[model samples]
Target chain A: MIKGSLTLDPKIIRQDFPIFQQAVAKPLVYLDSAATSQRPSKVIDAEMEYYQKYNSNVHRGVYRISVEATEAYERAREKVARFINARSPKEIIFVRSTTEAINLISQTWGRTNIQTGDNVLLTEMEHHSNIVPWMMLCKEKGASLRYLEVDDDGFLSLDQLDSSLDNRSKLLAFTHASNVLGTINPAKEMIRRAHDKGALVVLDSAQTTPHMTTDVRDLDCDFMAFSGHKMLGPTGIGILYAREEILDRMEPFLYGGDMIKEVHKDSARWNDLPWKFEAGTPNIAGAIGLGAAIDYINGLGIDQIRAHERAITSRALDMVQSIPGITVYGPKDPDKRAGLISFNIKGVHAHDTASILDTHNVCIRAGHHCAQPLMEKLGVPATTRASFYVYNNNEDIDMLIHGIEAVKGVFKL
Target chain B: MSEDLYKEIILDYYKNPRNYGTLENPDMKAMDTNPLCGDELEMQIKLGESDKIADIRFNGKGCAISMASASILTEMVQGKKIEDARQFNKEELLGAMGTPNLGPVRIKCALLPLKVLKLAIYSHLGKVLEGDDRNL
Candidate 1:
């Protein structure tokens, strides 16, 4: 745990988010942070400040406002680099979302590197963003895609890792933390094993980066991707961190505008490291907002945030376990998981359960959660998930429990 | 009590769905799945004389709204002419549920059975129009 000076108080923290103040028919118990987090006032204000003060295109313009805009944008890149403890800002490539980032890697890097008969190893718990791109890549390259099976407890089978890896394994792409199960995989160990087999690793950190301290250098992953919206920032902006050497060798995923140094008819020279990957007019205000979100998280401290979420998840597991006919998925130990719980009421469908909860304004996700394969493995059509963040507290969990009881009552279970 | 969407009737139907099974040598069978919620329903109908639905059954899994709607739909359309069953729409389904409104995300669940019923009837019509009278 990376400790910081700041302490978290959910009451005070909730004030930073304006959504909490909006009056509704019922009090809001938002437990859908795993889907997308609610943004704070500071993050919102940062974007407004950029547009209201100096809203100009970055990189190419020579005007004073453009320079300021460019400086703010570059500063946001630096903040993201520092947030993830990347060795250099050059490693940070901003894209639309984690989906686009993974697609970029699969198209540019995987296309050039992976050959026919090569293996792309993924886990059973991957989100569609992580799974679909690889499937496309493997199909195009005539390479086979393999999956490391997840057990009934939602933990990936590390025992099978040795056999799953071979010289033919070109890449190993897996999620750092599952969005549905909340099981935190041992990414560092997996990366080490993949490195021994000469396979590049892509860590899908969409769920991990927001809730925990992420140091790319410490994890030693070659490439990683996460969405800004999942971390209290604006939509339409995400980060893809790659090693400097690997990025230099990979081709650009998109063409035109700022990504090129010079364009002459049929041929063009690409721009420098990070900008080589970022094409056209970038999400300037979104990046600045993400920087402000990073500052906000830093103020609260990642260690404190993790501790607070762990406390909430521990209480939630304890309370939810006591509910009759309610079976929670993922690891039973709170420490082995992130701050989410996907579960099912024995006799009630997940959608019906979600609908009943909505009557009380308790927001949760109910579906296959974009992991349909995993849903089949779990033998459930869908599961209702309640994920927590820094702003959540015990009262929210209590409200959730009450809402669930109401579901049982309404269904006469 | 306060405008509850899942009323007693809906829950009752969900718990004990009517005409829930697979039909043997059914005249027409069709399946549809709600991609968003992973709700799936398969409808089978046996056409009797005068193109009436002699027997109907549905088998699959879904939410209370979808399951209850399927049960109610199977019961409503049984013994009805195929053309009349084809005219069933969202208003009638919602009215049967005793709720005038379904939130946007859930409306698909409420209407999946209707979609399956329409597809099954259309398929049966196509088969009949094509003059494939072996089973008819």
Candidate 2:
């Protein structure tokens, strides 16, 4: 248990985030990092500094602050490329969020490659962001969508993935770590099998990249997406990492002021890679905050964070399941999962559980978690989820348990 | 808001919901889901010889507040005139539930039955349900 404890103390980490000091309830127990993370003071201050000191449009300004803004924005792209071990900064495209990043690919890459009768492969556990774009693309292109089944314990079978890929399979998009199940998929092996079938892979790293080390080159995925807001950065900024060869060949997703090199009344040439996809003025402050967030994560060390979350998740899983009639979802072994846990009480609805917990100022997420198809596969309408991050610790889990007991008392379970 | 919710009466209605079943050959029936929370409700009313709601039933899956609201709504309209059932508002239904100070989100859960009840009546009467921005 001592080894399982966080090497970087959560109490100490909580002090870095201003949100912890001020909440409707004292000592905020934020267990919803899977949905969105609270930013640290460094990230917040970085964004504020961008707005206050160097508030200028990127790339267009010949003046001092504009150059500074452009430098900061491009430097952020370089940091992201290094963070994911991408081949070049040119391969990293900044967009709104993971949702918009996926849509960008669906528009630029998917619209061109996917043909009628070509099917896209997805897993049963993908969030709606990954699923809906493909569905829309398939519907528009007269293609179909197939899913790899998740087992009772929330693990996807590589054998099923191998069998599911065939001549019609154009692309396989899946989450590296599931938001609901917290299952850390065998991403490298999955990508290899899909490549063996001559299929492109889009890895949704929205959940994984925030919690642990993720190398796009090592995974050998064709594309990857993650949001800044889920990793101690501000919202409205995300990264899309695509293979340089493919990205260089694909047309731009968005066309506007910043995405083109020269424009005429009817004719124009697009800008270089990375900038070609970024249309209009970008979220400069958000990207700068993301750079600061990367610095903060680097300071803490990703491996240490992963280990700490693993230890705490194991403890949380154990403590959560100890309650009578509690059915915890995802891999029981913390190694097979990430930092979150989804579960349900036998008779208590997920919303009721969340409400009772809310009374104690213990926040949790209920409802389908924007994974209704996954919810259907789990055979439950909704499941209460208590996710964790660097700031959360044992006391938060205790509060969660206290809230669960309250739920049992109120509902007479 | 949480302390005000899940009162004994609310829990009682949730545990043993009144008229909690499907009606056979109903004169009016409508079903809708709260897209926010995925709470679903179906309301059905049978017309009696007096052109009133002889029987009303609703059943679905959701949180305690949603289920309890359905239970309370069914009881409220079981023998009311069709016009009276259509006139049933959120205030009346929430009042029946002892007027728990629900927040904006949970208030939707509490009023979903009333919305579906109104829809069932309006659809039967060939009139569009409208006017309340609160969507009662």
Candidate 3:
């Protein structure tokens, strides 16, 4: 069933990415999209066009080129808002990356709302970016930090959440998808539960926003953050989506030009919602490139992309599990996963597995995946991970399985 | 995949590993892991007079390249000076391996034992070996 959705002629998708054209020592079977996606021609061209034709500082200048740049930058924000079904461009604020976006929210909203003796709820699956900032805020505010435990398979246990939620829970920040485990959490339900407990929910959509359709309204999350680089756009730009009411409550994270309206020697009045959060000259080129990424994604359709990834993941899971010595991590059901899988083979360290795969010209991620807590929970120091994207196909999965088998054969395991 | 990448000599060492366990009377010890891939190594060295490596042993978990590399590394450095062993760089090691295409990951596996060796040797002898070029 998934095969039909993710099914495409690999030759066509291959055309869009120039890197695939290179005749490397081995086949470049890229399976690390969970880290950052490979860019298509459209995104590359969009950035090039901006630099070549309309290179100028935006928002401040009244000149034609600057006007064009400013318009392009704002238009990209509109595209981002639309991509996630956000209500308005005002809801979208660009930061350097998802880490920066999360930091902005935690420092601003967290400092203002969370009081001493209050609690901030997080999950064990959160990346350092999502977990550490909250930890910093909680430490400063004398607020306690609580955790929602994950199951043996690495899924967050709602039962743990049920027991943990309380009056003191002011903020519930968790990931929409586990970066290490690739487990897709039910954000809408999680949001509802948090709201019932009178706690605002923040979704770390860094992993999910790239692979699936993220309807912020449907999820009812107070804030959502994702990076542009992870979605085939350029690096150094990210998006933070907050509900208008929530945006009104937060303080500005950074204070500088463009974020302030009226400045006095002693006091300064901040600008409107989004601009207040985005201080200094923003990533205009990155924003335009992100817009092109949005267009590329839209052209393919996110649902279609999700379906394609599911297909690749299903095949990958089946193949990896079928191998006698392999120990698959995360949920067994492919439907519960997003676009990636993690596993280990008995007697094979993940790094070694990756090295053997590299000899085959297959690129995979091997490590804690920046989720040390999750790695501990999974009872492994590290695992080999193969994450997928829209351009990935069953052949890639086949290549991965073959690579693993070759590694096994080489080891005579 | 070329059979030369995982030569029989390397595989033989991995399967029938020498110095596979930690030293009983270790004069120096170090344990380190490649954070990127979770490959770990615990190396123990017994130093003779002049801080020569009287014997070396290792015990840990990793892939074929790492295990084989550890197996090869112990054999190469067991009777050498701690300082001389520290000077063994990637090129020298790769030259010893007879090829440079152990792949980066495997090379790291091969180097884990060496890194631990260097750290322990530096602390024990108060001398740094400058030959392990990490840039490769």
Candidate 4:
């Protein structure tokens, strides 16, 4: 079901990242990788290499430098395409972020395909990015938006999903891995079920691509969106991966210079598959940095990263639960989660817990995490989340435990 | 906020919030919520002779800064003239709490109670709450 079952030493991985060197306090234990990861020196150097060597506009100029720049840019796209196991590079379209990628599909394919009686399916645990766009599209098209319920243990019911999907269920969009609940939804099974009902699946892989391998062919999702920033690449670049057949049919999301074939005053012919959706000057440096990030992950082995996180998370779950008055959300099994934990200490608000942790120089996120409906379901205003990555180890877990102890001390609980 | 100040002042007021309750059919009352972090606050006050603040209480579930600030604000204004309590400001409130540095977002947590109390007073007097909330 997953890859890279080997273990790795995070200490060596820490040496490649420069931010770990400069600590504001004694130890800067970062437990917020789910928000955005700390970039490695290699990823940073790759962006600098692009600017220093071949900084020219892509596909427009005929000079040598222009040719090199275009190759670097398109090569990055090809790297992303291969990384996700897409059939062709043309299936991968570069966008601003996962939010923009979802909007592109909603604007083009959803606008045309979903009719007045059509229904779009979503889950209770979707991030605002997944929910809001479809809501806007469904409202505009006179189509209804429905949801599959999340159970008390934080898993979506497949039995309910089976009953809900029908001929009118035109599209089903859901998160591949929940950022807050830490639930890794069974994407392959969900896609298979949706396909059986003649409903297309849009997999939001923003939280999964970093922690696990994403094989588009294996899952058979019609569309997928994920960000580079969360996966240790630079911001301003993200991937919108749709199947070749669907991407070939959708119109351009943005229209500009690079996306056009031949233009007249009256009309213009659109460019090829990926370029048709990508408008204007692309994030050349950002794409190059993303390619470098992929290379680095490949070097370290994503499966090793996954196995290491599971080891750390297994230890963390037991450690966190040992403390009295602790309530951990999501599945109890480590295999069911990604690399994060969202929890709360009894009688203490998450805000107070986080600030107290800050005093101990242990960084964690404390808020609704943009999943307000999930918060309402959990009966919590917010949660204190500790997300691990390839750089995190047992020592950082100690810091997290120490910070949580400080919260207990300050509250005298 | 300073760790020392946080341990001493804020935690005390938060754990044992003074004047933390609701008054039945209160003379003046207002409630507000900070949508950013879901910090909620409700302040109820009863006036006496010359519209002096005779009784005051607050009720909410929030972070240390917000809860502590509400506790201190209630104690500081319980017997004062409504006019004087209405003139109370963030600087005075912070000063009374020993002036811990609540960073950008936490500062709003501290001001939530102050805003709700001001609105309660302002609404009873047929006046709108004044001053920028962040500044306050």
Which candidate number maximizes TM-score? 2
| Candidate 1 per-residue lDDT over residues A1-413, each given as its tens digit | 22232246878998999999898777789999999999999999999999999999999889999999999999999999999999999999999999999999999999999999999999999999999999999999999999999998889977788789999999999999999999999999999999998999999999999999999999999999999999999999999999999999999999988999999988999999899999889999999999999999999999989988888898899999899999999999989899999999999999888888887889999999999989999999999999999988888899999988998888777
Question: lDDT (CA) for every model shown?
Answer: 0.91, 0.90, 0.84, 0.89
TM-score of each: 0.96, 0.98, 0.90, 0.93
Model 1, C-alpha of A213: deviation from truth (Å): 1.0
* List of clashing residue pairs for candidate 3: A6-A308
lDDT string, candidate 4, B1-136, tens digits:
4466575777778888999999888999999987767788999998889888899999977888889999999999989998898888888898888755768878888888889988888889898866764345
Worst 10-residue stretch by lDDT in candidate 4 chain A? Answer: A1-10
Instruction: For model 2 chain A, give the 10-residue run with minimal summed lDDT.
Output: A1-10
Evaluated at residue A17, the lDDT of candidate 4 is 93
CAPRI grade of model 1: acceptable
Candidates ranked, most accurate by TM-score first:
2, 1, 4, 3
Candidate 2 local lDDT, A155-246, one digit each (tens): 99999998999998999999999899999999999999999999999999999998899999889999999999999999999999999999
List the candidate 4 regions with Cα displacement exceeding 4 Å. A1-6, A23-25, B23-30, B45-56, B79-86, B119-131, B134-136
Model 2 lDDT tens row, B70-96: 998888787889878777777888888
Worst 10 residues of 1 chain B by lDDT: B127-136
lDDT of 1 at A152: 85
Candidate with maximal lDDT: 1
Find the candidate with the highest DockQ and give its number: 2
lDDT of 3 at A295: 94
- Candidate 3 chain A vs. true chain A: TM-score? 0.97
lDDT of 1 by residue, B1-136 (tens): 2327888888889999999999999999999899888999999998899999999999999998899999998988889998898776668878988866777778788888988888788777784222221111
Which candidate order results from sorting by lDDT in descending order?
1, 2, 4, 3
